[model samples]
Target: MDADMYAEAIEYELLTQAIYKDILAREGVNTVNVQHNVSIVGRSGVEHQVDVYWEFKQAGITHRVLIECKNYASNLTLEKARNFFAVVHDIGNCVGIIVTKTGYQSGAAAFCKHYGLALKLLRKPTERDWEGRIREIHIKMTPRVPVSNETHPIVCCLCLRPASEDQEVRLKNSSEQNPNLVHASPSMRFLGKDGQPITEELRLWIPRQLNVLEREDGGPYKKSLELTDHYISANLGNGIELVQVIGVLIEYYVETLPSNEVVLNATETVSAILKDFESGEWEHVHSAK
Candidate 1:
């Protein structure tokens, strides 16, 4: 897998953990978060890092689950699961699991075939409609209002004082202008409430992962290209109404995605995400090398 795929793998694990925490645990099912790279002292006086160790209560029985995630690998064995479980078994009443990049070993399958005195095997499911996921992502990334120094200046919009240059500003066509457009102007500087000049870059860059998601799902609405693209892409395949979907995106992206780029890539990134939304194909744009 490439960098993009690697990122996806990392995100997948995190999502799985969230599912265990949010859905399973919230629904009253037994679940827990496993810490990665734990250290434990063995009978031999040697210490090793434990991949994941957590406790969950099932059937009024507290069970510690030690899990290892193998995002890039394909094969795992019953023997491996046995060792992991054994190591933790001496520590407490526990279960061991090894999540691999691919499918399992027949031996491991047989071992986990029984509960209490058994091992466990879990198979990752193939994706059905990725378009939906892409859309949800877009919604999360949707652009908010166009910011401005007057409406949303480097300094507080309420106060037109010098702000740190690091702040970003979203802007749209204004029928009237605010005489008090906030800025980092030296004259606006103050000692207490008035902040130092907004000396930072005004815009934040979008990450490649979100960029990929937008590329896939952005489109169809002819509204503000940026806002609509985010809405469409984010809502695709989710069965959510377009109005509600796009509204969320606008709120999110407006809150995030640089109003401009620090270097020169800002223009290109904005243009590209919008263009992809318009065209519904990220294929045309050249990815960052």
Candidate 2:
């Protein structure tokens, strides 16, 4: 593979490891190795490397699991599946898994099924598992223009106050050059009623959540029911206007707060905000996947 493909493959492997680790950890399996290299002695005395390995002891017996990540642009073919199955057969005493970024072809899937191997398509988790996990309060605000002469005038920020009554969490513009727009993943999209395209200069902001832990030194946890505000500034326009929200797509699940309220973690938030700045009624799709 080339440099880009190599890096992509590494990322896919890491993602797979994270996902499987999360799943296995919940199931009480504690041993999982990412990017693990294993040397298996072949019948001819030759050795081969296995990419990812996992093991757990159950009832005094150690059960081993092997995973191979393939980040290909197209579907995995039957030939590669056969090769992987051959490796598994040679290694012996393990559960084999093939994780593909795209998907597996029918022939390849059949090969894996015939050999008792698993095929998983690696993708972001859908929201079904996290729907009622957190408490949320939504508020809509427009960008305000200050009379003072500044490089960027209109300031629009989203302040979320969860039902927990925690401190207000603020999302402000993260870009110094733009001063009113924060970077967004999956990019925001808006459509007009005509089924055509409508464009508006918008800024992105990701909310932040805070956690409190008790100090081992005998200090209090200093717990707060409300969350602090992270700043995110956006310039929608010169005056107060309505932004009609249509839909929202979030990449990560909301986490439970100290007060038992659910909210988005600091590192990530809604990936795409679908709106027209007209009506506030928006559809929050928890599991469109």
Candidate 3:
């Protein structure tokens, strides 16, 4: 076969294997082994090439299934179906299935139906297949920002003095470039009472402290508010310990962002759509083989 034909054949065989494997899994047949591009010896001592093969044992009886894949541009004909039936007959005691990219001729469909052979059409989904289906999703996200205009002095209970201008007490390992901004993360660590290292997640203390501060100030107002009840301490470097947070100057505002749209196209993600010729049942499948 040429390069294009070889590539298409490989893709078609793999697609068939993936679809059947998924179907068997959904049916709770976990013991089955599904494989692609296998060769099975027939009773006549002739080895037949099987595009996709699967077998399982049930009640001490081993059952096999053989699949033939065709990636031709044109529809399958009656002659092709008959040729495949010969292969299935030579390799007896196995179910036969034929999958093609395009639909089959009326005569070929009738021939497969008469011989108990399964005929399936597997191909990329077209625009018509997406009728009444979800094609896209829209998500709206609004961000609330806390803007701090000024931060007053933090008092140290041990020394009974305010922290120096050079001292900085913020979220540890914060990625924000601005030292005045403090971001919240569960992974952030801080020093608690007696200079013991602890996470901000301990007893949900950090969030509770912020909630108390917000409640006492009645939202971010242009005034110096002192937190007297909460005495959560943090050790700034250079032997400076902040035991009391006072005169917090912050403002909260909401910023509305544009809606994010995501398009869901089956043709983009799904490799093929399998349709049973007899029952007219169909499904979209992603290739993993």
* Error in Å for residue 128 of model 2: 13
lDDT of candidate 1 over 1-289, digit per residue (tens): 8999878666545533443344345567663565545777655666755555567677999776665555545556677757755676566667655545454577665565453333222223223312443322122234433233344332221122112222212111110243333222323222222223222222332111123333322222121112122211111223322111111111112233434323433223321110111123322221222
Query: lDDT value for candidate 3?
Result: 0.63
Error of 2 at 217 (Å): 36
Q: Pick the candidate with the highest lDDT.
A: 3
Total clashes for model 1:
31
Give the whole-model CA lDDT for all candidates, comma-separated.
0.38, 0.49, 0.63
Q: Write the per-residue lDDT of candidate 2 for residues 163-270, one digit (tens) a residue.
A: 222211211122344542332322443334343335332322222211212123222122222222222223333332223232232222222223333444511453
Listed in order, each prediction's TM-score against the native is: 0.34, 0.44, 0.60
Residue 256 lDDT in candidate 2: 27
Kindly provide the TM-score of model 3 when superposed on the true structure, using C-alpha atoms: 0.60
Per-candidate total of colliding backbone pairs: 31, 25, 0
Summarize candidate 3's per-residue lDDT along 28-128 as a digit string, tens digits: 98778899989999889999999999887778887789998999889899999999999999988889999997789999999999999998888876677
Least accurate 10 contiguous residues by lDDT in model 1? 242-251
15: Cα error in model 2, Å: 1.9
C-alpha lDDT of residue 39 in model 1:
74
